[model samples]
Target: MDSPPFESFSRVLSETIGPLFVSAIIGGALQGVIGGQAIYYFKYNKADPLVMKCLVLFVWVLNILHYFLVVDAIFIYTVNGHGDPSSVSRLTWSDIAIVLVSDTGDLAVKSIFSYRVWRLSRQWYLSVAIMTGALVTFSFSLYLTITMIQSPSVMPNAVGTFGALITLAISDIIMSVILAMVFWKRRSVFPTVNRVLRMVILYSLETSLVTR
Candidate 1:
């Protein structure tokens, strides 16, 4: 039996660029969801504050740019590199940029949701803490990006990045727990709207976990 041609080449490409390729596909698909939500908000949310609308638009823009960067990274490794697997190991500007864009978008989203928490419960402390965690997460991502630029490896030491992710997850869990409790208490206060409050409690926790 003859050996298959390009077997080693295929393995190298799969190992080096597989995750990025898959991530870009998933991210592109989610962009459609995000776009739909943005469109609905713009069409139906005339009563929203100008600042709020602007913030939403800003986040949407960041998400779009991030998606582009992700695609550009794939192009850089696969297309631009002439299908050379070793090209994936060389970090590109798009790779570094995606990190900053992603982190900034996350911070913006957390700040918006934290404001919602404040509006519902008037708990300044919790909102502040969540924002603090988001900031910390962004800071760590920035550090990781810088480290990637300085290091030789495509995936650099990510301890700070991982710690930031853990902190962000904890913050989300804490926020959801507080939100559920607040909603639960309100269920007793407004008996007629109890069902709606209970649903909100479930939704908040479910969304938090799903995002995590």
Candidate 2:
């Protein structure tokens, strides 16, 4: 068979996708470090340390995934010297392994966070609803990632990473809204409402714009 178009795509993808993912990794790392520190020091009565730890895990996973996506994109770009599809299609098992590991980490964070919320609220109705919603969103995001990577052909850029990033932004918004309502109802006991409120809002807005 004729050599597939890989070189050209690689060059363009590398130049653009590589830098974008690198930037995302930097941002993710910074957020994880800063947010984790805040959670450690702030002593938010409303936040369970276990739940907060899950949030930190989520952030850490984001950074790890960011690095994985960037490196994979760069490698693929380099391999596809001039858009040759053959080598691109020949992705080693290691590549799939990396993606699988990161995907698992992503799911673990989601599960932990959902369990955390359920444990904290102790409200079956609300907690079940939140967990269900999170699961649905996670499924959609994963489907998007797989479709982008393996269908038709290999994507020149990191489509799965972008989908995950968007999913996170949307998830943050949903979670923030729920937490805000809880805080509003228990304002008397939850003195750190303002801080948690700010973090949720900032996380929603800030992550919404963060590209991967």
Candidate 3:
């Protein structure tokens, strides 16, 4: 007898594709928030230079592209591969291609933030360290993206995944600590100034934690 409709999809969801689908859904929702914010910024952003606006638009474009890719990826598994149980095991071009967009966006944001940090602290060493961390992440992502493109059926390497996570964790820790120290060094004698700086440090730490 032929299997019932959605049976394969149900199985995949129950077994393998559930987490990915949930993540995609969450990402789509976040993208909506980003789109709204982008629109708001464009409407009210009179002070930002033209170049900065363009940069924001570019990043927003990447986010939109990533959202579509995520949708397409799920669509391929649920709609295109509807009857096949093994389709979820195989990687699609979308899966491999997403790394490029995601990594490029991440690198751009990190580079911008690190550049600003360098401007504020004038710390060449901290900038270099952050850049080096970003480089490690980009290298691993590029390698994985290429490897998957060449062999779509190949599963991700454990060592590569671990290395990437470790590099990211180390980088975030360094960034959080270095930023706190930099701000702390600028502490003022006034209680109010010190309180504001402490709040900034706390916010920075919290932001890093979220990214981590």
Which lDDT values do the candidates have, in the order given? 0.81, 0.56, 0.79
| Regions of candidate 3 where Cα sits further than 4 Å from its true position | 1-12, 36-54, 189-193
Stretches off by above 4 angstroms in model 2 are 1-11, 14-16, 24-66, 79-106, 141-170, 189-212
lDDT, candidate 1, 1-212, per-residue tens = 22343465577678756887898899899999999999999999999788778889999999999989988987887788864645755778888888789889988888787787788789898788778888888888888888877874557656867876887787778778877876775666666699888888899899989999
Question: Could you give candidate 3's per-residue lDDT for residues 1-212 as a string of tens digits?
Answer: 45754575577667756777888889978987998999998999878678667778888998888878878888898889876867877888888778878877776666766776787799888888887887888788787777777777778765655666777777777777888988999999899999999999999899888877
- Across 117-194, the per-residue lDDT of candidate 2 in tens digits comes to 566576666555556555655665566546545653555235555655566556656655555555445444455866
The lDDT, on a scale of 0 to 1, for candidate 2 is: 0.56
Candidate 1 overall lDDT versus native: 0.81
Count clashing pairs, candidate 3.
0
lDDT of 2 at 139: 64
Q: Rank the candidates by lDDT, best first.
A: 1, 3, 2
Provide TM-scores for the models: 0.83, 0.54, 0.81
Comparison by TM-score, 1 against 3, better one: 1
Q: lDDT score, residue 126, model 2?
A: 59
